[model samples]
Target chain A: MENENLIEVNHLTKVFASRGVMSKGQIKAVDDVSFSMPQEKPTILTLAGESGSGKTTIARLILGFIKPTSGKILYQGRDIWKMTKDEWVRYRKEVQAVFQDPYGAFNPLHKVDRVLTIPIRKFKLANSEEEATDLISEALGVVGLKTDEVLGKYPHQLSGGQRQRIMLARAFLLKPKLIVADEPVSMIDASLRASILNVMLDLKSKFSISFLYITHDLSTARYVSDNIIVMYLGSIMEMGPVDKVLVKPLHPYVKLLIDSVPVPDPERRWKNRIELPRIEITSQSLQTRGCKFYPRCSQRMEKCSKERPDLANVEEDRWVACHLYQ
Target chain B: MPDTLLDVRNLIAYYMTPTAPVRAVDNVSFNVTEKEILGIAGESGCGKSTLAYSILRLLKPPGYIRGGEVLFKGSDLLKIEEEELRRIRWKHISYIPQSSMNALNPVMRIEEQIGDAIINHEKISKGELRKRIEDLLVSVGLSPSVAHMYPHELSGGMRQRVVIAMAMALDPELIIADEPTTALDVVVQRGILQLLRDIRSKLKASVIMITHDMAAQAQIVDRLAIMYAGKIVEIGDANDLFNDPLHPYSRALISAIPSISEKKKLKGVPGFPPDLRSPPPGCRFYPRCPHRIPGKCNVDEPRLIEVKNDRLVACHLYR
Candidate 1:
């Protein structure tokens, strides 16, 4: 049966035990998160938040780097964790990942060509050596990189933008249904970020590849993503279409986040200064019951402390987990 | 002009590699006025940090100032003796190095680290030092108890605050913060930038903020300088520069920034930044600039010239 959804994350939760000698408690890195990608439509969904917000944890969970402590992640109607060997291989090939640090992703010793060639050989993407070479050049060309310039060079020889593009090319070669890009353009220079982002946009429209674009930056998130998921302290603060969620944020946390993003225009400088919470929200101090963002939220209420708000649909196709909406 | 706090004239610093001298900061000249925030923005390897280090005479071996005059309070910093420079280092001028948040000593308590910076410069009583440390922590929006805790106990933003507190320990007239908020998150980064702005006003200090983040520069900088391949490509009032940039490199850079308020087609500057060791004879950004005049840009290097009131640009088009 052709599954309607490409990937479905059902009530996903990941708890990491805090190893600090002083505090031996569990950190709920991801808490009761659920979303899905459609198999037919290619869309860029961004998971954006500050550091320690569990955006990367969700990416890791989806990529199967670490097993979720609870909940099911169904890929094409199959449980990813309980997949057979064939299913696992198919899953790995169909789902690709591009990490933040381009330099760190590649083996320093290997030539850059190995990044493309090894994938082709392993996945049996080509019938023969000639076909593999053709495929390599095509993939590189798709990402706007010439084969000769990048093929024989070491990772360090190329600029950060080129290295990142090479990673994109590698992903393109696999013809992945989904690519979990975690901070892909954050390490690259500002001038080079647009090219990489444009390439992601092109891949979506041209090749019809869905992207789970994870980043802390809202500007870029708003640029490429069709949908946006705002996470804070291991829970979804808001999730909806990018235009609706970012423009008219229902949750106070999303509003604060959008406000914090420094607009490039000088005409619209920030008027009010934000007051950060003096007390740090450590895992040990997390109430385990209330809204996770209560400590920092500006519009937090008394009800926020007593009961946790579920990810409730507050608007048309917009979901906000906040007491204000309730 | 608003009482120039620091004036840099024809500053040139190069890293002497075995093969050749990498002209990291070449013919860079700018000034910081009283209580001004001057932002130096460029891609990595554009020598933004080196320019700051050169101003302080902090460059190590393989890196030396070729030619420059750093006039701080009417005195030539480059020609000053080590003894005179040491006295002026923290008292008159201070530096917050790039990623200095992680530079804190994990074992030492925050107070001890802050105290070390103070006693090294001047003598103060233990009681006075303790009180000063508490005051510094509170000023940066941290609690007094933070002084007693180790670096590991504080979050990234809080540690950054502690570093800022240490920089302001002596109440210097100028503070050079290199990528002060690069490692931080958006909300945390806003708070830190605000703290820097507050510190500037409270202490009446001029700041030279070096970062590639143009948005962060827009938020805090009073004047902005765009650097390309070891040279100042554009400099103007932050508002004017953002409103209408002159240099093609500056225009490309400004346009490249993704904005949530406006959705427009973004284009990265084509090609890579030229290697500083063997830069092109003409315009360094010629290869990447969209408005490159083939024969002219490849032959004649453009000099930084005043295009308008307080606006400087280095480009053949402007000339």
Candidate 2:
């Protein structure tokens, strides 16, 4: 059931309960969510949402960092939660990650070479010392780093772009099938941000790798993604081909997210769209009403506040969860 | 003369480091007409921050204004003594850094910080300073009660407003902001940018915003200068630069922006900006410029000259 899809996630839910006396109720980081990674065709899919959207929880869960309370995750058709030790090793090689902060991932004491060396050794890709150095150099070269300048330099010594590239080079050296990049370029300078983004885009061509580019910036997601999935409060609001979804987004949540983004154009002022509610909608797990976005939705009504809307197909290759669209 | 509010000519500023001399702003020349917002857009290490620090005469060592003149109104900022520069700082050219959290002091209340800047330059007494601080806070759209709160108590947006209010404290002729809204979220960023815009019209003070976010620059800046390595490769009106980018670097940057609904693939310029200390001759962007031909760009240095009406570009193609 799992191997048919590259990664098949069905009803993935994570709920944490506090231990001991003066106990706390369960906190659901991720609610029942179902998604599948298509076979063979690897496109950059964006998991976009603001803080507390449970996007990060989903990433952690998929990476085997946390166990889901209910539901299952199938990587290359194997249930990841129940994978054997040997399977987990193979799984890691298939899914490599580049975290948000490039510097935080590496020890400051070690040089940039150490960052690349760890991955090669972990995967056991290199045969000998000379082969290891060659592979490191090759990875560095792909990311546009010079061995003479940055090889011996510490994380602090390299620029933000270089450090991120070194991290990326480390990931690419694994020759992973899918790369889970969590806000990979947000912390760096705006100019260097694009460089990291390009590395992900080019990797698809150079290494035949697919990227799960996670970010809050829709503009960046639009730039690098082949498909887009808009998430809201622990569940996906919409998912489809990037062209089909973004240009004509059916979900109210997706519409609001797109509207909020400051379009780079200065000529025409954006329409005075409905403002997002300042309140944090945290009472999420008790089972949602009509729509998760009902409280914040501009077109929300009495029906929206009462019924839990199901994800419906509004168009070809697009799924939206909105009452108005229905 | 348009009452040249902040006039800079041939400014040479460099970071005084143990490493090779960083010619951050090498013979860079520009001027901000009174009440106009001039933005300097460039990547990190391009010296946009160094330029802002130089104009304020606020270079904390490791960074020193190497040579050239920074004439704000009639006064030569470089020629001014430390005592004179201090008097001129908040009064003539105020500064707002990337993050307001660090710019403000933790121990003191908000009112005191605003009052301190007022007292440092003006002859106003404590009673008069309190009234002025209240007015300044109100002008920047912050509640007057905020003056009672410490820096940490307020949100990022509120603290930024406090910083803006501080920058506009003395009603300075020029406000140099280095990535003022980069730390904020989209909605918060819009609010901060609106506040800056509101102040720009009311105070009629020139704003020199140094940022790498071209989107922010397009939305706010009247004119823009694109820097590569440590040189301004292109400079023109924001609209013109975006629509008709003359330099290859500027073109690549404009195209680099991800369109929300568009499907076109973003073509990132193949290589990185050259090392400042030992930049190649001819065109500084020659290494990455796709149009680079052998003898033309590799042989001689290209100077920034007028390419079209009110637009300047530095490239052998333009020459």
Candidate 3:
């Protein structure tokens, strides 16, 4: 995996058994998902889906927050969960996460600077107080923040964009090789959304870092992602180069997602409106017969309801799980 | 006669706080005509929500309309009595809040909640209300059985439809939906937009759809108003707004949306929105405007003047 790819996730399947007394079932959050990221090259890989589509579950598995019931998450040819206590600590220093809420990440009582400096103090990467300050300042600069304005301010004092930038600064201060950003700009103002995304793009070029950006927004995914994976009902529907996947969709789910978005085109309207029921999307009751998307899929076939489709190599650099393409 | 259902003239409303007056809405004016869908686009603190709240008469405490007039169906609502305005609220003008689904009471049954709206606005019995609720659910692509369930039992899209159904209970002349479909997915967003359009055309009611997404607005809105720092800088027909945006702010917002139709780099608008408590000396957008005429735009604020035909632009370049 280390030869060219930075991480290789092979046959990744996550299963969660109900722990509470009332519930008893095996929930397959991510089922047989496989993909790899190249080394020395940083690119955005979008894991797009609606709720219960296993997008967040995949992110959790990659970060080692939850272990996959059956599979291997290879980070530089080493199993992420197989790491020892010391090794796990070292890995934590290399991988950081930017959550959805910027303000929610920190304590209400603490100042913004304290939140930014926590990892530095806990990891003990830099000795002495002065050395830690220098490292913190450097990280803040990378995310394009002013130490003067943000240092003494609390989460309430700073705007949504400022708080988000601080979160990025903390991630950078770890000097992590990869950052798993989950809905970083979803909560911010639309005007400030691009600024947050631009910082992620800037960091990739400046530090040779890789990003596993998890989002539901197709527009932002199109603008930043080099490669993308579309997930639906705990399964990978499609994965390929962003340009090919978006421009020439091989799966029906991906096509519907692309067409559903009103593209600001005054002349064109999607005449073929696919009707979707409210209850059909409830993930808790999603029991697959053949394909997970068969219920609402417009181009669904009779064969789709009887046999589960397998991800096949359709063409160069494109993988699809739809029977139509297979 | 402009055929306008609701007309707002220099609406200057603000929250009269003890520390300082929060100038939420400042001399903003727009119109929503019969069978029209007027979209108000802006960022979070751009007075978009304040304007919507003011229209609904839902403002509480220190918030008060300092000046200006709100003309709805030839009646000056700003000067109306509480009882008279209450009658007009749901029967003539109804508000579909941003999170109107969540705003629904959880304890009560679905039909009963809508029944309250129907009962408050119009004289209707339980049998009539139940039929109206069923018909409302059917119109929004939901099963009539949903009215028997609680809020938690129904899905988010279904809950949103319920809110819309309640808003449509009185067969109001106007429906004000603020970020109605924003919380849902793309597919559901399209469905909800279609539902709003269907309600507007079929019921012959005007719709005021306020949102932040420009692409989403192009789907259904007949006209658009771009607000910034408590001021409407641009207003025009939806097609004109997208095709020939005279204002720099409007152009930046339209360009920011990465759509399938266009492949150009979506250039983000630079600089933060001006602080409303103590705003800048001149133009609110001058600091960020890429085409700002340095001296003129920086020193004096521009007026919302008719630039070309039905298009209105509040920029020195247009003036």
Candidate No. with top lDDT: 1
Tens-digit lDDT string for candidate 1 (A124-232)? 8999999999998999999999988899999989999999999999999999999999999999999999999999999999999999999999999989999999999
Mark the regions of model 3 whose C-alpha exceeds 4 Å error after superposition: A16-26, A127-133, A278-285, B125-127, B260-263, B293-295
Give a tens-digit lDDT track for model 1, residues B175-221: 99999999798888989989989978799898989999999999889
Candidate 1 regions with alpha-carbon error over 4 angstroms? none
All models: lDDT? 0.92, 0.80, 0.84
Question: Which TM-score value belongs to model 1?
Answer: 0.98
**Tens digits of per-residue lDDT for model 2, B61-136:** 7777788888877789899798988888889788897776577898899998888888877898778888898888
TM-score of chain A of 1: 0.97
Measured with C-alpha atoms, the lDDT of residue A250 in candidate 3 is 82
lDDT of 3 by residue, B57-90 (tens): 7777678888888899878888889999998888
In model 2, the Cα lDDT at residue B183 comes to 62
Binned by DockQ into CAPRI classes (incorrect, acceptable, medium, high), candidate 3 is medium
Report the lDDT tens digits of candidate 3 across residue range A1-326: 33856677889998877675655777888898899887768877888888778889888998888888888988777789888898788778777899999889988898888886778789886898899889888888887777886898778878888899999999888888888999888888776777788898888888877889898888788877789998987889999988888888889999888888787766675566555583434545564668888888889999999888999899988999989977
Estimate candidate 1's RMSD in Å. 1.2
Q: Please report, as a residue range, the 10-residue window in candidate 1 chain A with the lowest summed lDDT.
A: A276-285
Choose 1 or 2, whichever is better by lDDT: 1
- TM-score for predicted model 2 compared with the true structure: 0.85
**Models ranked on TM-score:** 1, 3, 2
Which residue pairs does candidate 3 place in steric collision? Answer: none
Among residues 3 or more apart in sequence or in different chains, the pairs in candidate 1 whose N, CA or C atoms overlap within 3 Å are none
